[model samples]
Target: MKNFKSEIENPIISKDILDLENKIALYYEGKIDEARFRSLRLARGIYGQRQFGVQMIRIKLPYGKVSSEQLHRIAEVSDTYSRGRLHITTRQDIQIHHVSLEKTPELWAELEQDEITLREACGNTVRNVTASETAGIDIKEPFDVSPYAQAVFEFFLRNPICQEMGRKFKISFSGTDEDTALSFINDLGFIAKLNKGEKGFKILIGGGLGSQPRPANVMCEFISVDKIIPLIEAVLRVFDRYGERTKRSRARLKFLVQQIGLVAFVKLVKEEHKALSNQTYKIDTAKFDKEIILPEIKIPSVKIKNMETYNLWKETNVIPQKQQGLFAIGIKIHLGNFYTDKARLLAHLIKKYAANELRLSLRQNILIRHVKEELLPFFYVELKKLGFAETGYNSLVDITACPGTDTCNLGIASSTGITKELEKVLTNEYPHYKNNKDITIKISGCMNACGQHAMAHIGFQGMAIKSGNLVAPALQVLLGGGIIGNGKGRFSDKVIKIPSKRGPEALRYLLNDFETKKEDKETFLKYYDRKQEHYFYKLLKPLADTSNLQQKDFMDWGSNEQYINTVGIGECAGVVIDLVATLLFESEEKIEQAKASLQLNQFSDSAYYAYTSMVNTAKALLLTKEEKTNTQAIIITEFEKLFSDKIKLETPFSEFVYQIKKNKPSKEFTTKYVQDAAFFYKKVTTYRTKTRSNGNNQQA
Candidate 1:
């Protein structure tokens, strides 16, 4: 492979890309283990697909902001490196699939030329930092959250503290109390607020969606803008230290908070204050507060082919911006899939007429901002040519679906196929719902909720139902899930299991009953509350009857052959290697990183790296004894209990490790900590070698 070091301008990013190149070489040479290499590539946003030998590259766009030039660059890279398709995720990132593994570094270098990054887009790092697409223009917002979200994204991108955690951490910033960003489902959620003319945020912590969904707890009703970053850092430090590690199923921050009550978790977070690099980080809002410059070109006159269709488009797709006459247009992408040809055209349209920038919404759609009112007709006409002028931008017809069996390894059924059918049902049979924003529909390939099905008003999860001797593709219908606003939301309840072919019929039944029985002007959730879960189960139970099955019932949507369950190993959490030798090798690597950080005068980062090295060293030794090490906290305690007398230390093992929290990350303290960590590693290595020589080696 060719070197990408010269192509990337930023030294840090260049090094990162070059490192990926070198690691790929090492893995091919059998020098690096598959699990270890998998983690490294995943952290760089290269994911394994359901198909063998191809990769999915997730581009991390902070808060979903993308300029026309960046969009064009992405399209060019996609066309060159993979298939000419761009998939917008629910987290506001774009993914390109079916790329060769060897070409990833070059692809990443190309993206960075336009200031786009893939670092921390996947794996056990802080994933993309997302925010409301209408953030800067929302009339109800106290202030724009784009700058703050950018600040957090920049601060933690390559930070040593969060490079590897037990599970992925997600954060979001809601522009208003409407919570369009869905704060209730993130690890750290911030809602912009103003108290007595002072800028701040309402913080929500420890929320997630999977097989189990948990609503976030209100950590603080109001915290100043400057304190939010520090607060997040403290929370991450606590989670890294005590969160579950061995069990991938229970590794999320929500589980940690659930295991040890909120009060105790909060106390642990507070204990991390001393080691934090900054007590408060004031974001430079002025950088993002630039005045909007409208285009100087004359408005083009376009004849409307249909006045009625134009009127409906304006009603559902056009949004009036907070600025006097400016507007934002919403493009409801079908299942968030669009081709490069249409992408280039949309990019050109936005650059010449509207704002040069656009936001990829959390709903897997696009929001074109700063569009002038006079250009509306021209945009509609131009977008119509590209098949981009679809109505119902965020209404009931705008369904969100993940790339299920299409590419995901864990997909049990086709989310996109069923989504296409359900969307047809809404458009052809229920046209009036094009303007209805009261109900939302989402579909996920599985229970992991990548499509955020658990939080939708009407949701479907892909599954397989076995009928005695045969298996068939099925959908788990869930209802009553929706955002209640103000950092509150509810997860849907499972009502019934029906064949994927019956999904459209199930929707018709639910909609028909809702239309007939709902009270005047009642929302979907209110109506659901009145009728209850059992009521909906009874309403849709007939569709669940599988005794009378057809030939098509055995086939999944979009598949020609009969259904066969072929779930692969999921790479969403990355692979974890448990080899004792690999752990020791990783410890040495961490020590080198600590030494490099110390030389660069990054004391806080050096200290954290050293702390991690010590933890890895201890965990490796404990594994030699076949000890049950599940978390950093448990590793610390168990190591001390088993080896305290054998190894001499200046202080107790707990005190030595806990010094990272107790002492400030000063030069003297950091230098001593790194030296202590090195000494501890040497001792453990010697002990392990002695044990192995004595024929006492145990498999990890």
Candidate 2:
């Protein structure tokens, strides 16, 4: 025992964090709306929303591993600095709602003290890095991904070039193909892989979920962690320079990945990787003994022969542990919620008894790893006392839902309330489903799809209705959704809408239908797929169509708000281009203009000039510099430029300047272009900014 030993320590937040916070606070409060405020807000994790009076703040949690102390701090921050609640986003990041414009700087400083940050969490930058919690510990895992995830997080924490990219970039790492880390659906994903004796990762780039969803592309076969930064830098730089700068919506890396094949994209990334600094993957594992060790556990003695209850838990609740004889137990939390006191207690209990090792699952649940099998029964009793002893993990009652109407401003319906009721109804009646396999029932409060209801087995979406005097909210039924293998899955389709009060009944009908319609142990999804949606909806006749309101899909018909006649006395007296007659009437003027531009040449169609002019006018009015534009909409501009001379019956519009690539002399243009111009023209002009300027007037 010569003195050849080592020591370990936890890293603290950088001192510059405080100084940076001060500078940001001065800028935000003083209305110093210069380059500095813009720069810092991107760094401080502040995101401006389209809603009139609110903002969303994203908090970065490295490796999906968070401290109980940090959780409590966040809870406090929500109660004091925000809307008294914290939102767990799909990206494994926490979002704070309705934060006052002034308190942000203080909030960032507090997070800095806890070694957490908002820097580059949002705003066209490298978002929070995600990794599998079982990175090194799960035997199913090929290798530990924590080091690689940590490396990427630190490498791009504030890298200047990659800081403000085309849009936010999401990076994820998975140790196994089981892929709880959602590597397949990220902007950059690395699923662990090995060949021969060399251990490495499978790289994917460009996946995202929004209005436009696309899966990522695999760039590397198996690149060592040593080149992770350079590889990422190369990919992002290509996205920055070549991505569509004109359109905000289509500017995601996926669009570029589509335009340039994955092979070409990886080639560019490999090129950029050569220019960046070469970093080492060599870490001294001995340096972080505390970080690597499991949380301390309070070993209790429950010496009994029958371990049936414990066995059930081991079968359902526990996940495989990479270390022999150790397992990770999943403590299912309904709707990813725990009160302040409950959270605080769990933190201490975990640190003292569960080896200080806790991880959150994608299903909005918690997991405690490395608990000894013999001490498990005693641990189960403790967990029981904490009111968390529900041994059924991934059972019916273990449903996940977004906060919905309880908190979110964008919520269309009540998710937490519905999830709670749905969970109770299923657990009370559908106990047979656990053996059937893990059925995920997710609920989204609104069309924004926060719950990712798109990926659940039986998804419920919240929607509102305008009935005779009152407008009530209700849940819409979406069946047949879940993970097939890895992250490749399809979204559930909305078969019908059910009133909130009748949700339990509707769900029961679905479960009952599953039993009767299924053939010899066929899974629920298979039956639903074969039976088809109409057959299923036919079962619940009126319940399926709860509103019974003639649903013509607002987009297909038209905006109800546009029907309001405000062109006469509105504050902003812009023309309301609603009816087809309005467009057809414009033909009279365009024909007259066409007579002048044609120079004695008789035009075949007079309505063509009129239609083109109307569309160009509408396009000009809709497109403006005060707002951001997407490249997908550039065709409208191109149309305007192509029909300029023919569209001489136009008022001076600034939007026409950039539209249409070249105003060449031509005569072979068809009326289809004119019709397209008119079709898109009406949709663009009818759009209105429904907002209130006074911040205090808005409600969540």
Candidate 3:
């Protein structure tokens, strides 16, 4: 590996990149544990892929907003380091796969040149903050949520409190009651609102989609914009203090909220008020308040070869902006995959004619904003030149899928394969359905729902089916899931399971059935609800038969050979650290960070770091006893019961730890908290040393 240059303008970002470079060196030299190093690299957006020796780097674009220069830079970097391919995720992040781990720091440095970032893009931290792609242009929106979303993203980008949590946390901002950002399925979802012309948000907390889907509860009907930040800070403090640790499956904030009732959880969140960094944090929306600037270039005269196709494109791809005389064009990207060649061309197209900005949609497409209505014909022709003028953006034909068997290790079957076949079916056979936006079809390689299969009107989860001694790729068909908007939604019901080869047939059956049985002017969700889950189950039940299987059926899509289940460890969830020594080492690191924070006058951050250090230290000792430790709340209570009598203490462990809530995060309390954590660490280390010296005494 070559030495990395630190030419970054921001001192903080320069140090961060340098730290990553140093850690990479340490890990290669066998100084840092692989698990700890993985966590560090993941927080910096360097993720391991299914393929060995290469990485998938997720570039976090806050709210999916990307400028032409940044897009060009991303394309250039992809061509230089990656395979010239960019994969847009459902969360509105772009992922470039197959890059050398050693080159990630340099890649990040180049991205930062265009004000882009990969920090906190992946790992057990605050993931990308996504909002409606039409946020600023929505006709029904009371206010543009772009600034608020950007503020939240900026506030938590490198915040120490969320850097290393038990599991990943997600936040979203919906433009209006339509909830295009899908607030009902995030850790913290904010819907924009106005009361008497005062800007505020309706908050939803603890919703998520995974193997187990849970809808978020309404945390508050309306909170002023200034108080949103403080409320979010308080919730994060509570989660950091009490969320699950040992059990990775139950560690998400959603699970925590489910275990403890919402009322009690809110109580815990309120208790952290004194420790909040801000009681009321106001955001400056002036920068984003400006109207989008459109290029002054005259519209080019282009002769349409086919007026019918152009009209269709205008109807489906062109969207009216809230601003007069401007329109947004939606480019329906296939499977969210586009190459750098087309990407660079698109970048040039936007820069030359539009507002030089594009927002990637959650449905794996692109939205070109600020295009003059006169430029519609020119855009359609130019985009057609780049092969990006696909109609049916976000319609039934625009299928959403994850790179299942292609890149993700948790993938069980081929999501992209079935997606391609189904897309072909929709495009070639049912052209009339291109305008249908009511039905959404989503696919996941596995039950984890990275593609949001659980929330789709027609969903398919990858599975494996067995017939006697033979096994074949399968999909669990689900139906009736759709967003009802306004912070309310429902998960799809599992209908049936069919072989992956039959996935296309399954879709045809469902569509044909709905087309036949549905009453006039009836929506898909209403029809499904009326007919119930059993109707769909029985309709597609014949395809579920695994008795008659062919060799080709055994093979998954996009593969020439026979199918084999090669699911690897998923990095979406944080790595598990079972080593007591590693836990103790991390505790020491946290203590040092606390001291550094205190010196910097970040008292609230310092206090939280100290609190985390105490929990880590206690958990390390408890692990040695082979005791059950799941959550931070449990660790505090259990440590007191198990170790209070053994160790000489000035105060009870519960009272000592709970002092964080009782007192404000002033200099005095921050200093006291840090000192207490240090003292507790020393005592725990002493106890461990004595126990080992006493010949492994059980009670030591």
For each candidate in the order shown, give its overall lDDT on alpha carbons.
0.94, 0.60, 0.91
Best model number under lDDT: 1
Q: Residues 205-271, candidate 3, lDDT per residue (tens digit)?
A: 9999898999999999999999988888888877876788777888899998998889999999888
Q: Name the candidate, 1 or 3, with the larger TM-score value.
A: 1
- Candidate 1 off by > 4 Å: 696-700
* Candidate 1 residue lDDT tens string, 326-383: 9999999999999999999999988999879899999999999999899999999999
* Model 3 misplaced regions, further than 4 Å: 1-5, 696-700
Q: Model 2 over residues 549-636: C-alpha lDDT tens digits?
A: 3432211111332111111111100112223333333433453444443443322222224334544344343343223223223424
Scored by Cα lDDT, where does model 1 land?
A: 0.94
TM, every model: 0.99, 0.69, 0.97
The CA-based lDDT of model 2 is what?
Answer: 0.60
Error of 3 at 492 (Å): 0.9
Question: What is the descending lDDT order?
Answer: 1, 3, 2
What are the clashing pairs of model 3?
none
Clashing pairs in 1: none
